[model samples]
Target: MAAQAKRIIEDAVVRKDAKVGDKLLDKAFALAFKGLVYAQIWEDPVVDMEGLEIGPDTRLMCIASGSCNALSYLTAGPAQVTAVDLNRAHVALGQLKITAIRHLPNYERFHRFFAHADHKENAQVYRTMIAPHLDAESRKYWEKRDIRGRRRISYFTRGLYRKGLLGNFIGLAHLFAKLYKIDLSKVLEAETLEEQREVFERELAPVFDKKFVRWLTSQPASLFGLGIPPAQFEHLAGDERMAEVLRRRLEKLACDFEIKDNYFAWQAFARGYDRSESAPLPPYLQRANWETMRERVDRIDVVNANMVHWIGDQAEASLDRFVLLDAQDWMNNAQLDDLWGRITRASRPGARVLFRTAAEPSLLPGCLDDAILSKWRYLEEQSADLTRRDRSSIYGGVHLYELA
Candidate 1:
């Protein structure tokens, strides 16, 4: 499974016939991506749910990054969510979350195991309660030792959010801030948007302009932690310096929303969800929605496969919604055509497709074949609205398309 997963990721990321330098970077990205990457997906599920307009009858298909969106979508009562991913660790993580939800005794335990994610008792809880019910593959994945020689399950006891590639990337960012005597967490102390903006402008924004920070951001490999491949890095930077682009995104994350209501901010600044009782959380982790997620968790089918290939196998007009995340930024024109061709075939009438991009404009305008692209209409105004509302703030665009 591990070998096959690596191959699948390479197929999606590594472009053959590219220049030598680009090919090397792509290969390095594919290799780094083979292990655990996103312990929690970066996309905002609220914006996704709004864009997709999920319903009770909705049959959704999505890239199951960390499976957070898949589980969160259950709150809308989708009939089925087929989540496909090329990473086996993500597949295992998805399966584990579903199994843990079903097997864990109550909401508090479930919250601690996932939300708190640093309780020493979590490993014991998994062993005594959740492990027996988890599938063999997921169980083995948790039991296996990581490169650090510690069992993978020990992450929950230490800090699950601080373990994956993104986790380490954020850790590095914090370390750089520390080197400059800046506290990234200071943004979290602001109680109002005004104060948030003040703190960001005064503290975090200047770090991006530093000589060392600008040089670091200029390297394509520097953002591997955020899961941005070399190709996507080009799109993300566009005409600006990479540091400037990053500064803009970070500014939005810090100032666009209130800290009290944006869990994404907490994750970015504090490296975990807020611990306060009234803290905002992903829909799946919210106590009020816990029962809904637990009841509909079975509706999610996590598969270790490429999404386009899996959609190609589904019956025509069978799927009601699709969530592509920012994956299209990683694809070439031909790959995008293939994916949209299958998506067009599989989409039901009025079916919605939601995806994010590294740039402000939609990638489909000239890249996707007209035959497939014309079958759907882009919701320009609605897309703009959701893009602004996206608390994650990592993406440049959050686009929506509906079958027309």
Candidate 2:
């Protein structure tokens, strides 16, 4: 099984020139991602929505990490949205969301199932309302029992936010913070940015700079929870100490974004959503967007496939908005060119492409074919601006590219 999983990873690597070590590392990443990586998409949808400027005419394509953003895009009234992920688990999760949106009785019930996300009744909601609407594969993925005799869907009832690889990683981070006598959750109570900064400096910063924390972050395995592949780790960790890099990013997460409405910041500091704090929820989960989401839910198609191949088969000039969301950081030069080739082929005139990277500045300048690269105008200033506003302050950069 392990060998087969490794081969799957190798075959999925778009770059033919990927080194053996890169291939092995990608295999580990693929294996981990296949299980359950993100329960919630981390890239700030607010930042992405601002960049893409989705409209009724837009046809969207994205790498569906957790499907939260793709579903969120539906609220923008795009003509169509298709999300592709190599991980079946993610695809299944997207499918389940679609099912829930379509069949659930109301927004309150839906919010309780996902955002509140920890009540035994959620399983009953799933079996009675959501399960019947799901396709066979998604249904099987959620309904299948684990060794503990618990159905995967039961995670919704046990705090779904605390479950995936990213969630567990945050939980570990909180544990480590506690070891240093710091309670990271206190960052949530700060009513102002200054207060947030003060709290972070007084509490979070000292613990983060601790020797044990620094050493743990320096190791590659420590970041697997962030869904970061070895290649991405190398990209983000270049020259600088990983501890410092993390501290800078965490500072932005804690201080730059207001805790009152920044759910991403709340999640980072508290390891859970601030339900009573007026912290804004993802658009898909917001009560106001439910009607739009339900009306357009049919437009979202979830596919489990390699993104490059999926984009390759797409019709010319059909897609208008592309959200890569840090996946390019995992690609080598050849893989990047291949992926961009497909994007260029599938993009309509005036298509806007948005992606994030683990390092500042876009990766396409020297890596992709000049012909294809020249056809898109890099929105450098806007990307820089959006990166600063990105509530999920984990990425080193946010990039926007528009067909020229």
Residues 14-46, candidate 2, lDDT per residue (tens digit)?
235668876666666666766778988999998
TM-score for candidate 1, please give it. Answer: 0.99
In candidate 2, stretches whose alpha carbon ends up further than 4 angstroms from where it belongs are 1-10, 13-23
| Candidate 2 clashes between residue pairs 3 or more apart in a chain or in different chains | none
Candidate 1 backbone collisions, by pair: none
Q: Candidate 1, which ten residues in sequence have the lowest lDDT sum?
A: 1-10
Alpha-carbon RMSD, candidate 2: 2.0
